[model samples]
Target chain A: MSEFFSMGGYGSYIWGSYAITAIAMIALLLATLRSLRNSRIERDQLETVLQARRPRRTKKAPKAS
Target chain B: MHRFAKPSVFLKLTDPLLPWLAGATAILIATGLYFALFASPLDYQQGDTVRIMYLHVPAAWMGLFCYVGMAICGAMSLIWKHPLADICARATAPIGATFTALCLITGSLWGEPMWGTWWVWDARLTSMLILLFLYLGYIALVNAFDDPERGSKAGSALALVGAINVPIVKFSVDWWNTLHQPASIVRMDGPSVDPSMQLPLALMILGFTCYYFVLLILRVRLELNERRIRALQLSGMFDERSDQEAEKANSYDAGHNAEASQ
Candidate 1:
């Protein structure tokens, strides 16, 4: 309703306060999520590369008679 | 506890938690906003101006809560040298800063209509302004050093010192007579607020709590990965050293074998 939007003439202040707060909160959430996603990918990639670089151990056979 | 610091374990623990927290945060915020904006009645004293309380109060609560969280994490890191504690403290800094900004901004907006100005040097507002400064100072000090360990240590010290302001901000109106109102929601007696006002306020607090959790988890996960990268880089250095050592040993053995045959 227009009443809800207007907030009885205090609409600008009320809605502005809410809107800025909401945007800040959402922006924070999105940024946090994005950083988390990026970190996960980085961790996975680092794990893979480190695994590949790790030394492999193999046993040597005894000399033939 | 250290085992949980491992990225894999952290990831596994957080995987199930993220969805639940995200969902809860969404529901709480949505419901809270609905009640706050649509269902709650306007104030007689301040008309719709009191609506700012729904956002302002929660942000103020979170600002306090986060600083406490940071200080506790800082203590853990300093005493135990726990990596996760350092990570937690680091991750929480920005979140606290954001909440403090929200609190100040909403407070200013509320003040403009009620006080005929956007800001004042009142004790509560002044102390809150100081709290925001403290948060910014902590963030800056934490990242100022070239050595991350040194930075974390310095940051912990700053966090502990800054915690003295948290209580001051909470009680400033009581300690000093100021234009800012005293506690109406939580007092020695029952809350002075009406049920209609209280419901949306309560919902906003709940929603803010969930929001903090979501942000905390995300930040913690990011910090863990950052540590993982550091560890991998160190491990790479180790592998390179081992490769060179093995090459040297192989060449020595080959030279001795050739000499013995000759």
Candidate 2:
């Protein structure tokens, strides 16, 4: 109801605090997730590249047979 | 503890706990918000304006909590040269800064209506502002250097020194004739707050704590992955000279100078 929104005439202050807190928390969470995802992608890419470059067989391979 | 400090082990231990922590954070915050806005009664004195305490107090508490965590991690990294501790300290700075800023801003919003002023040079407010600056300074100092190890060393030193302000912030109201009210929930005699008001306050504090751990885990993983990628790239750049070195570095994060720092 409009009465609750008005909050006995201190509506703006109450709502403002809640709104900003919500926004800041959400923003930080998204930023953390985005960076985490990006780093995971980067690490995976490097890993695949390293795998391709590594030797396919060990030094103690099967004798000529 | 030392065995689990290895980056790989740390990640494995924490990754499985992430979903549960995140779920708890979401649930606690939602319930806390409900109680704060609707279920709890308005203050006879301050009316609806008291609702701001739900956000302001928790943010303030978390701001201090994270700072203490950073300082402890700083000591661990300094005394034991724990790379994982260094990563944790670095990951905590931004989150702490965010909460401190939240506390200050919400406090300001509440102040304008209650005190008829938007700004004051009170002890509590000023020290809290200093805490925010400390977080910002730590983040900048840590990332300033090309050598991550050196950055961690300098950053941890700063964190240890800045810890003096946490106690000052906690006791500022009692120590001075500040406009800020004295502690109500945490006191020698026990919480003076009403049981209903305490419900939202306690829930929000727990929720914020859960949120911090969830982010700490994510950010620590990010830092570890970045370190591994750095080691991998360094090896890849000089692949022709020593193929064996590259292979060694490719053993995941083992290339991060896992020192025998006993």
Candidate 3:
């Protein structure tokens, strides 16, 4: 087990490479997912507001076909 | 290909594919890691340190892969004025930059123990650094303009220009007398790597490619939604009638898409 970890004295380099790769990949994924979610939420909110305002009619409003 | 320029059509096709691509990415990466760490044999020359090649090689490949994909998308955007292509080019930049950075970092780590130095101005290394800068420059240029259309145009130009470096980076080792070793996996003859080692490398490369697609899909969708929000903001409705207001908004959305695509 220890031999596997030390990797014949090159453990730090090997482990560091793998660890950083994992972190960077995960970070990019999370950030992209978060941006996607935020944009989706913002668009939905704007569309909802637009929808609510769409039904609003003035007293003198003409019938819209 | 031109039909894919429609955001609705693109989204409809890709939305169903996201889950499946993400699943493939996870499975491939997990299995690759297993092979890389435990299943593969150590290099007689470098000992266990060759494991670094598993991550390093894949990251480098992705860096180049994303750049080529971006360049192709940029060309399509320029020739066809497809907003989807522009969005794809924009989406690919940061991911490409991240992979390039990973390549440099992992190479540095591997180099310290093997090459006895932390840095070098070797042909391959220097060109890779340039590739990272190119990605950064594209990101900055696209966002620098106030108008998205102008930004996309300027960015497409830069991407097309920087594409000359792709071939240069690929052949830098062959062209120069550098300390960096010549190509082992991709040669005119064939891959010179051992079969056991090849398994991990191939798996990791495929895993990384799938991961790229997953991120690409999400980012493209994000850009499409943002475009809609912008169009909605620009086409504020003053119509009092409910039906007309809805109609006006839909028309504005359609007009915005049509103007760019035309």
DockQ of each: 0.70, 0.82, 0.78
Question: Judged by DockQ relative to the true structure, which candidate is superior, 1 or 2?
Answer: 2
lDDT of 1 by residue, B1-262 (tens): 5674786776788889888988988888788888888788888889888899999999999999999999999999999998888888998989988999999999889888889889989889988888888888888998899788899999999999989998898888899999899999868998999999888899889889888888887888788777777778788777766656766877889999999999
Model 2 spans with C-alpha error above 4 angstroms? A56-65, B1-5, B240-262
> Whose TM-score is higher: candidate 1's or candidate 3's?
3
User: What TM-score, computed on C-alpha atoms, does each candidate reach?
Assistant: 0.87, 0.89, 0.89
lDDT of 2 by residue, B73-133 (tens): 9999999988788889999999999999999999999999999998899999999999999
Ranking by lDDT: 3, 2, 1
Give stretches of model 3 more than 4 Å off. A57-65, B1-6, B237-262
Chain B TM-score in each of the candidates: 0.89, 0.90, 0.88
Question: Of the true interface contacts, what fraction does each candidate have?
Answer: 0.77, 0.88, 0.85
Question: What is candidate 1's lDDT per residue for A1-65, written digit by digit as tens?
Answer: 88777877778888889999989998988988788788778878878887776535111112211
Under the 3 Å rule for N, CA and C atoms, how many clashes does model 3 have?
A: 0
- Error at B25, model 3, angstroms: 0.7
Worst 10 residues of 2 chain B by lDDT: B253-262
Clashes of 1: 0
**Candidate 1 C-alpha error for residue B90, in Å:** 1.5
In model 2, pairs of residues that clash are none
